[model samples]
Target: MNQLIRTVTLLWSLALTTGDDTVTCLYSQECVLPCKSDYREIIHWQKLERQTTVNVHSFYSGTDQLKYQNEAYRGRTSMFSDQVSKGNMSLILKEVRTQDRGRYKCYTAISSANKEAFVSVKVKAPIKSVDIKMTDDGITCKTSDVYPKPKISWTINGTPKIISPKDPQEDSRGLFSLTSTLPVQPVQDSLTYTCSISSEDSTQTYIASLTEEKTEIDLGQDITIPCPGSQGETGNFTLTFGSSTVLSYNSETPQPDRIQWNGIEVKVTSKGNIILHKLDSERHAGTYTCEKLTTQSRQLIQTSVQIRTASTVGIIIAVTVSIVVAITVAVIAYVIKKRRSKTSENNGQEGSGGTGHNGTPLDDRLQSEQLVEKRSGTWTD
Candidate 1:
């Protein structure tokens, strides 16, 4: 009867000492698998895998025994050495990976007491951002720094389009980048596209369009690129010329000097318009994109600018005027030459018909009389 009572008490004590918990961890971040006690001598933390056990960390004899630590968890697991005497047996795991999601067993032992705890860890990598851009080939949807891989899809004007995306490229940190394109030839000018990136637990979407605002600016004139969703509002704004960042703005503390294109300085208006003085076609004519980052959503707007030089127009007008003047001069010369030719022909005809020296027709009677008089005078002499 005494043996039975002792066995019952031991079983109750063991039951009271053992504990289980669950913790949620973010991928690529630090997490603490919690274990606590008032006494500690040896600690062992291990992951429970199917049909096997993997060593995560272990501490004994007043030092960490990590020589037998699992290769996958090396340099990623540690415990608070100073707090071990106070019975803080929590393990600090850094750079948590998706593979670390499983059951972990923390065994703590001392001279007269022993306790064990189980922590079920769940690691997640949610969708962060989805970026969509307009390209010559088409509009491309892209995202980076996501984990567990992701699926990208596109919708055109509310109709889902079937697309084959490239394989998600994995980075050195085990995150993934995904990109997909859509040909714009068959799409209408007012077409809109929405790109969605889906993970196991979250989805992020961004909407973009082929309809771009067109602005024509004269060369040497100042150009202002406006932020799309920032009318009277305030937040973070990023302006990019093509692929280069031209300006970055924050409402708390604005730094207009963050404009980094072509070693030029610019001004940001209260309404979030970035002004670039003395625009040059070679330097300033292209796509300008403004992105507004807010807590609820991200807004993007694009503008296509064309720079016209006044000198070019002036040259064209000058050439046109010069051609007109040359044509008028040629016509005047031809008319004058025609009149001179007619005058010469009339003079030649009168000369051939025996006209007087002053170009007059001679009277036959007068001429005969003059001849008789002259003849009489000669005979008398």
Candidate 2:
């Protein structure tokens, strides 16, 4: 009896020596059974077998509590031997989920004395799959198989933005499912958008991109190429006529007349109008293209000219005849001048021959005078 009293006294002292009890457990996981302290006075710690039981209590649920038998904790809970020896009462939980997150109190009873410890469990949900939907005006993002319900947001080019909830519902899976709709004000066809969801333990991000279709205007007549004001983007632009560049603006002034056909410069006016001055049938036919230098986007406009072949042929013939007549007249005038010069030369030579060194040769002078008289009479006739 004295020895039993001494063993009981030792057990009581051991329990009292273990200061305030503390329990630790992860949220959403199976709770662990806290281990009881062993009587230090006992030489063989393992030999002194003590039957222990654990109970979980919650202040929120009145008159309701959980009792965990030793067999019930077989595969669920475990105790750290080191912590148990140091009088540290802590619970190690496993396979925790969001629903398992809450406040817990662990009670360990050995014989008639009981030790209690308090702990808070926190569980975090991991993002599973990300779903992205794209529309003409905006984008929608969703995630499933997640716990603790993540917060959703948006990002464009890595810039963060707030996303409000569009439709929210909670399913039987005890998961918060929500859809976020972002209004794409005056939607831009070239911008890329992204949606991101974040949770305490994990983060999931999805990307949805939209491309806007533009209406092409066939520039049949005069047209304006709208220039983005201060909000404009700088890029290479091409102005082409049937696969050929009529004009190109690439951050600099183009070389003038570099692209010319048939001695005419391909001209784009200051107001962005392509003017085909003196447009003839050959020059007016074919398609004109306006294109983005870096992309495959192109706008084609075609034009045609009607010409009268007969009128053109008549004008050509008239010019040819005039040239031929002028050439013929010049040739005839040259021939007449040469004949007159030869005749004058012959008359001068005969006169010189008639005039002798002695001032006259009587026969020669008589012959010359007779010849002149005969020629003058014939001419008069």
Candidate 3:
């Protein structure tokens, strides 16, 4: 009876410990088995002398089974304890990533019966810590301490695309990792691009875009378009006026314009002055652009011309009228002075009774004398 009672007590203890179980862990962080306060009680405390066995298994296989499977955790993960007493099974992981953080199970098995404890693990990565780098070729997105692994992808104006590893590599810390390179082809206008990362339990995302700088100018004047001052440099350095190539120099100077009607050829001197002469009217208004073929620098210059007419007939008429008016005034003043002198001489001859030229009478003689006197006075005074 005592032996039967002991066997029954043992079976009851094992039964009490058998059931579906779980082990929880914070993503990318350490996960403890048996949890903090979890333990199994034996029905007869004095009956069993050996510690029970606990089996811990991850739901996924290979590297995926361990916490964190994304690129962010490529070089930083490890397990804590492989095995322990039935009441104390758990795993310790280093540099826990968000994906590594999650729920795990600990199973205590005795004979054919099993008991389980479920644990929840939470993982987090702050958005503020996320860094984004944008370049002409593509963009780089990164963050630290996200567990398991995060799914990386890109979005262009709301369209989604996956970001895969350019080449797979492993760090000294034994974390799985990858890097992705994206091709950038821009349209006529500006565009925006976004990068995002996700896991089974949480998601983190980043975004950035591209912008182009532009300039404009007008025609019919003079301009200096830059050249590829150095070698082995590449860029879009174009020179155009309206739809025509006014001047174009990239790796080398281009051929001169066959038709010089609206445009003219510009010769660059050793002093860096571009000389162009007689740019006509039709090409009067438009933009001229000069840029360094290899460098990012650029400049724009504009040109315009205004023509004036001269009036010949109006000037000739004004000069002729002035000369004629001056000559007429001089003649009139001379005639009036001569008439006044003659009248005074006649009056003086009558008053003095001077002899006339013929010597006709005494009065005539006196008149003649007076006339002589008057004439002499007029001549001297």
Candidate 4:
């Protein structure tokens, strides 16, 4: 490796280029290093490190020659021979590896003058996520199974601050794992602490937040729930009711349907609060959470939401039942009135039938009274 490093340095020192060029490639992806020359007499490609130079590919005469190609670049490196006549001396490096990251040199010789160009290959692995927590113990940032050890750092608001990480542990595959913690200190302003991971050429961040105050809302009222830790600022946010996403808001535009901001049940306001209109017991009575997610960082508070919906609203606010009760009372009163009227009608019908108290016909009673009156003269009037 030392010999290779020296050779690379010598080649770079000897080679000349018009301007510096750097090429970025995703890990495990193919990359091409641009090198073009009119001369086909000889061609060479080498990987350059600080102290070592490793041969990558080569061509000469009418045939291919790779006897000096480094073992690391053996099968993964290739050149387009057909384009050599067009002064194209580009080299294709296949399936980029973490160890393959470095500067590469391509030199072509024709007659006696040597023409060369250099291109640097950078392998990038973006940090996908980081674990973060905020509590009485302060903040904790952690990650594991990361290729190329990572550097964890913290920022209050957006200013860089001092952060110390625990000793990193390397796994059997040479991957690294580590953790860092930042102690909590009282701050009068709304506090937002961002934890970031620097992995290779990419970065990822997670945010821990402390809200300004607790929340309280009345039942049957429209409640606008601000994202936890937002400090009352507009931003990209997501609101979750129970375990489901009730709404999400992006500062870019308005969304429709479900958490789309136009759908039923929830609305993302201009102030960044999720408005729960006409709160109901079944849907709005449970726990709620607000989260913030971005490509560089992601954070979710399983309990970020504390919706202490007043439980006293259980019985007083049954408006529909009140209407039903009023209708029922009216119906009962009408039925009683109708039944009394019917009873009065039946009594009048029985009295109109006119049966004498002794169960005799009225004509017979009159005739008896007349006969008695004829004999005793007491029926005259």
Best by lDDT: 1
lDDT score for candidate 4 against the true structure: 0.67
What TM-score number comes out for model 3? 0.32
- lDDT of each residue in 106-166, candidate 4, tens digit only: 8787664577788877765445567776656777777776666677778766778796566
* Comparing 2 and 4 on TM-score, the stronger one: 4
Off by over 4 Å in 1: 12-20, 111-113, 125-131, 153-174, 185-193, 203-211, 217-223, 232-235, 242-245, 255-266, 275-283, 293-299, 310-381
lDDT of 2 by residue, 62-154 (tens): 122224333323344434544544554445556654544454554444554544444445554455445554456566666665556666677
Highest-scoring model, TM-score: 1
TM-scores of all predicted structures: 0.66, 0.35, 0.32, 0.57
Task: Select the stronger candidate by TM-score from 1 and 2.
Answer: 1
The TM-score that candidate 2 achieves is 0.35
Angstrom error at residue 346, model 3: 88
**Candidate that beats the other on lDDT, 3 or 4, i.e. the better one:** 4
Q: Give the range of the ten consecutive residues with the poorest summed lDDT in model 3.
A: 40-49
Candidate 2 local distance difference test against the native: 0.47
Candidate 3: what lDDT?
0.43
Candidate 3 per-residue C-alpha lDDT over 1-381 given as tens digits, one digit per residue, 9 for 90 to 100: 999998887776573333323444443445443332133221111101136322223322212243324344344433323223333334444555434433454444444454554555555532323344445667555544443354556766567766554433334443334344455646533333555545326554433222222322322344443333323444344445556665454445543433343446566544333445444343343444333322212222222223111233355566788788888888899888899999999888875664544445666666778789897885333
lDDT of each: 0.77, 0.47, 0.43, 0.67
Misplaced by over 4 Å in model 4 are 1-25, 48-53, 60-71, 110-122, 134-138, 143-149, 155-163, 167-178, 183-191, 198-213, 228-237, 249-253, 257-264, 282-287, 297-381
